[model samples]
Target chain A: MDWQIIVDSIPALLEGMGLTVQLTLISLVAGFFLAIPLGVMRLSSNVLLSSPVLGYVFFFRGTPLLVQIFLIYYGSGQFRPVLQEWGLWEFFREAYFCALLTLILNTAAYTTEIFRGGIQAVPHGEVEAARACGMSGFTLYRRIILPKALRLALPAYSNEVVFLFQSTSLVSIITLMDLTGVARVIVARTFDVYEIYITAGLMYLVVTYGILWVFRTVEFRLSGHLRDRALDPVEALKLHP
Target chain B: MFDLKGYGWMLWEGLSITIMVGFLSLLLAMAMGLIGAWGKLSRNKAANLTATTYTTVIRGIPELLLLLIIFYGTPTLIQNTAERMGFDIRLDFNPFIAGILTLGFIYGAFATEVFRGAFLAIPKGQGEAAYAMGMSRMLAFRRILLPQMWRFALPGLGNVWMVLIKATALVSVIGLEELMRKSYIAMGAIKLPFTLFFAAAMMYLAITAVSMLGQRYIERWANRGIRRA
Candidate 1:
């Protein structure tokens, strides 16, 4: 209800928002690329190709993001000598680097699972059609499967992106001044917990809706052919997200 | 590297607390989810709007923020209300109670979607047939709808449980000595963050892996005598 306090907090909060957005976008892009091969491996018929990816996915998805962050961030310190000898200590030493790495690894696993589902859900006929055209295995995956899989995976992938965005807040626990972190700092100083948190939550809500809007537009464009042209946009938006 | 450093009992106690928190939250979430599903599936406009708002707002915010809000907001809100009523007394949130309530509320929004989907999956004719057999509305729901809904709801509920259990880790932020908190403490005590946290991670993975196997058996039991699609 302290309207002025919420207003006073926006500038600082927006600065925090910058970090959140940075972490989310970087990790999502990195994770997506990492997931592509991981996903393909996950769907491979060969156990050797698939099982390692399975273990990676199983471990990441099975544990909490917080634990992973702590494990990577603080855990690396325990291996300082090894990391230093390997010249990897510099990377693990920065909280930002550790947080980003954790988010990337975490999102990659979830994205791999989502991508695998999308690939598996791709019609067999399509793959067969490409094969009949003498498309090589790599070419077949590139031209036929990846496109459809990406399209099919968009909604789930978008959810992952949004989740990743929300998750960037956790970086604050290790001293990254993300949006939630800024709000927490302000609240600690001012004791205006409700007002500050509400403002932060509203900021997150706006970004969440914005992400949904972008994804809906992309989804609409990607799957336009499969959808009935006469169906209203409002109706389509209601189906998911 | 695999040593627990005499903190094995600490972890066991913490794991029990973690499971307790997760279980209590799941129960509360199930209750809310059922009500939310009813509200969503109901014809009443107000009920539908309320359920929709709950899910939308909860889903839109980060779980950490929501947990923080409840952890800090509850006592403050209570005191302000009491002040307005001419009596002011401070009330502190028991971290366990706070943890379960926030997690339950958050996951309930998710479970609402799960329950709604499950309810929608049930055939209309099955309920109609139950009614035709002279079952009252309540009887039809209990005898016909609930069981079938359970079958359809299992996989989604399984996913919810997976997420919810991991989410219990967030509760550690509010001073709860759950697995994550205990791991942090042990890590500090032993100066072995990698070993302790890795051990903690495996403990979590064990919980989820076992739950998955349990889910498979439960799914089988839930779908007993049903034709596979």
Candidate 2:
């Protein structure tokens, strides 16, 4: 309830917000690119192509992200000598790199599934129509299927983005000075845990709402011609009554 | 290249704690979900608004941040309020209790949506038919609505449960000595982070795999007598 404490802490918390936003943006971009091929592999008929992707998705989604973060950050240390020999120790040594790597891998798993769902959801008839027009292989996928799948994937992908943003908070545990980490530090120093946490929570709320707004705008733009202009009276009745 | 000798008991104990917390929180979340769904569906504006706000705020923030707030901030707030009331008392949170409460409350928001959607999927005519048969609202709900809602809610709730199980790991960060904490301890002691955490990950995957089997059974049970697409 102390307004002054929250106000005074804004500058410090905003600094942490920078790192949080950076982590989310970088991982989401990297994960998005990596997930495309993985998603395609996930839908393949060949066991060789599909099973590994399945296992990757299962492992990442099955375990806690915190555990994954710990495994990558600390577990990498156990292989320090091997990592050094391979010249990868330098990348693994920095907490920032470790956090970024974990985020990218984790998000890639979830995004792969989302993309696969979207791809599968592409209409069968439309695909056939494209084939009837003699469109085949890469051109068919590029010109027709991929665009629709991306559109279909937008809502779920946005949810993943929100979840990913919230998850960046976990990097604070690895000693990254993200928003949550800075909040913890401030609370420890000032013993004003509630106020500081509330402030941080509000900052998160603002960011999340902002993300929602962007997704809404994107959905609105992409949904043209697909969305019903008028609500169905029967459906409305069923919902309300 | 590490050994787990003499650490079997510790790991088992941690697994038990993880299951314990997961079970208790699942129960709490189900209870919250029921109440939350009722509130949202009720005719009262206050009830609807309260449910809406609860789901919105909880879903917006990070679960880890919420866990920390509940674990560290609640007791301090309570003690300070008690002092202001001229009562000298100290309050402390049991990490187990705090973990269950926070996780349950957080997941409850998600459960609310699941239950709400499930309830809505049930046709209004079924309840109306019961009422026309001289059945009271409570009886009508019990005999007509609950079973079907369970059927519709099962898959969504199953996904929530899977996430909830993994979320128990967050409680370890609050010092609850769950599976993740045990792995951390073993890793620190043995200097074998790779082995310990890999084992922990395997244990989690094992639990999730078993849960998937259970979910498939429930889904089959729920879908019985219903036509499929």
Candidate 3:
């Protein structure tokens, strides 16, 4: 292993880390917000609203993220004329924004399914009780359903977060200088593909482990209510029965 | 618009390669998964530790990264060693081998969890009962355990298979001539990337849907002997 080269590449790697962190954070935040409405839309009784969301999720989830990134990046370039006519080409022209948009959209589809599962897992009695208490529609959802569903969704959502962080590496192919991209550049320069890739692998490992740790901690904290409930025999019997 | 003239044949050829790669690698992945799961479940501490380490490192790294490392790094290492050993045979690493190995490495990690969980889900009494009935350890496992493990792990394995199908696209990064790579080439030749990619996406969806239906059939077959009442 070239220890000196690895040490010297720290600053460059850190710069690459900025892109990785930025892409992962932006995508996760956007995906979370987008997931709520998308999830609801997928489960909606109305075919009009639900079909588009269904198609969107199917298209995004069925294909590989790398292909999606390529389609959004290189494919958009083919439509430069159409985008320019609408004065929207500027956003699609930049690799960074295009990569970010693809990641956000792709992750949103998966997260929406997670949220939908969580929502479906909510007991029907809770909704009926909320309605009986004069808390219907948005008010009921806001105060009761959403919270319970989110708690149930927390574990799967954390897995999505870890997946998104690992996925951010795909953006490197779209010309984004994320950690993987920087590693590719270093490999091209030094011709030490093994050492550079190993270093990059280590960097990604640290980030993934960090994400896993934080999510595990969050999962523990959020599920604490269940732990306490489990300790009470009466509550357990009531919930079970 | 679709580029029928340029991409029709290419997509067909790529589809064959994708199917070939997925099936071959699934075989390798299942073998690795079975071994890894058994190793982890073994009473031996060293076996468990080795299996756990493999899962951790492979799981943590991105599949694309692993593909790149294997595709590029392995050849140079092989060639250097070959030259040093005065070997006359020229060793050129095949992309199919590289793609299969990479997918196997990644899928093995996932299969480890699925198989281990499925094995644990088997009631302990079944194995014990079989053993007490004059069956040896291996006989007990073959007769009482493997069938149940398969049934329990079917859903998880299906999900992994779906992921494995999609992940075959990563092999295109190293110019494996898979669907994505073919689409990329067609896009360059025809200058119509959106249509080509959309076509590629539809092809992928078709493959996944068929596999899903196949999974349902297998599940039905597996559950046929069980009592529904």
Candidate 4:
């Protein structure tokens, strides 16, 4: 293993990592906000409200994000005249914006499902108790339902975030010099495919494991009351045995 | 204004390749999953650690990066090792083989967890009952454990299958000429990116829809003996 090549490449890869992290954070933040309402609507009994959200989720989840990026970045060219007329051509013309748009839209769809599951998993008895205590409408959801649902959603949402981070590599295909993109450039230049890729892979592993650690800590903190403090190890062993 | 007439055959061929890769990788992934689950469940510490490391590392990296590493790096590693052994050989790695192996290996980590959870969910008494009936371990596993494990594993496996099929699209990056690649080529040839990609997206959605229906049928068959609310 050539430690020198791997060391020299870190700065370049880190440069790309900046964009990758930015892309992930921006899309996740935007997607989370969009997903809240979409998730709520997804759980609605009204077909008119729910079906559109369902379709949005289905379309995004069904197709690969790469195709979505291509369609937005390249397909938008088909409507250049219309976009130009509406003065939106500038935004669509940039690959960065197109990639970000696709990421936000794609993540929003998946996040909607995650949030909906969390929302649905909230116990009915608790909602009834809140209602019996005069909490209703927005107040009930804001005070009682949202907190519990978000807590339930956190684990799944963390997975979604990690997956989204890995997926940010796809933006490399769209000509953005993200981590994978930069790694590709270095490999092409150095012809040291294995070492370069291994370096990049390790960088990704660090980020992924770091995220896992953070989420685990968050889960431990949030579920403190749910922990059993007095469980006997001998009894646990007997149960398993 | 897209020219499907010119590229319809290419798209069809791409769809076939996509389906082929998906099914082949799914089978390979399940095999690996079974082995992984067994390893994790086994009493040996080494087997347990090996399986744990496999799942952890594979799950941590991007699938795209893994595919690239397998495609570009494996042959070089093999050839260099061969040279060091004083044997001159050149290995021509097939992209199809690379794609299937990489995808299968990546998804296998996920499938391992699914199968492991399913194995754990099965009541211990079922297997013990088989043993008490003078059945061998293999017979007990086949007759009693496998059936119940499938019932528990099917839904999770279904979700994995859905993601696996979509993942086949990623193989196009390695130049497998799958549906996504075909769309890219067609778009370049005809200059109608929207039309070609929209067609590709529809094909993917169609495949997903069909698989979902198939999953429901299998789930129904698996659950036939169980009472549902």
Model 2 chain B: lowest-lDDT 10 consecutive positions: B1-10
Scored against the native two-chain complex, candidate 2 gets a DockQ of 0.64
The clash count of every prediction, one per candidate, is: 0, 0, 0, 0
Residues B1-229 of candidate 1 have per-residue lDDT tens digits of 7887798788888999999999999999999999999998889999999998998898889999999999998889888889989997989899999999999999998899889989889999999999999999889988899988988889999989999999999999999999999988887788888888898899999999999999999999888898878
TM-score for candidate 1:
0.96
lDDT of 4 by residue, B62-130 (tens): 888898889999988888888999999988878798999999999998899889889989999999999
CAPRI classification of candidate 2: medium
Q: Least lDDT summed over 10 consecutive residues: which range in candidate 4 chain B? A: B1-10
The full ranking of all candidates by lDDT, starting with the best, is 1, 2, 4, 3
User: Residue B159: error of model 4 in Å?
Assistant: 0.9
TM-score of chain A of each: 0.95, 0.93, 0.92, 0.93
Q: Candidate 4 chain A: worst 10 consecutive residues by lDDT?
A: A232-241
Candidate achieving higher lDDT, 3 or 4: 4
* lDDT winner: 1
Per-prediction RMSD in angstroms?
Answer: 1.8, 2.8, 4.2, 3.3
Please provide, for model 1 over A99-169, each residue's C-alpha lDDT reduced to its tens digit, 9 standing for 90 to 100. 99999999999999999999999999999899999997799999999999998888789889989999998
Instruction: Supply DockQ values for each candidate.
Output: 0.78, 0.64, 0.53, 0.58
lDDT of 4 by residue, A1-241 (tens): 6789999999999999899999999999999999998999998999999999999999999998988998999999989999999999999999999999999999999999999999999999999999999998899888988899999898788889889999999988888999999999999998788999988888999998788678767777777787677234333211210
After aligning candidate 2 to the native by TM-score, how far in Å is the CA of A107 from where it should be? Answer: 0.5
Over the stretch B1-229, how does candidate 3's per-residue lDDT look in tens digits? 6655656789889989998999888888888888888988999999999988888788777887888888888876777678779975555668888899999888988888788888988999998899889999889878889878999778778888888999999888887999989988887788788888878888898998898899999999888888887
By summed lDDT, which 10 consecutive residues of candidate 2 chain A come out lowest?
A: A232-241
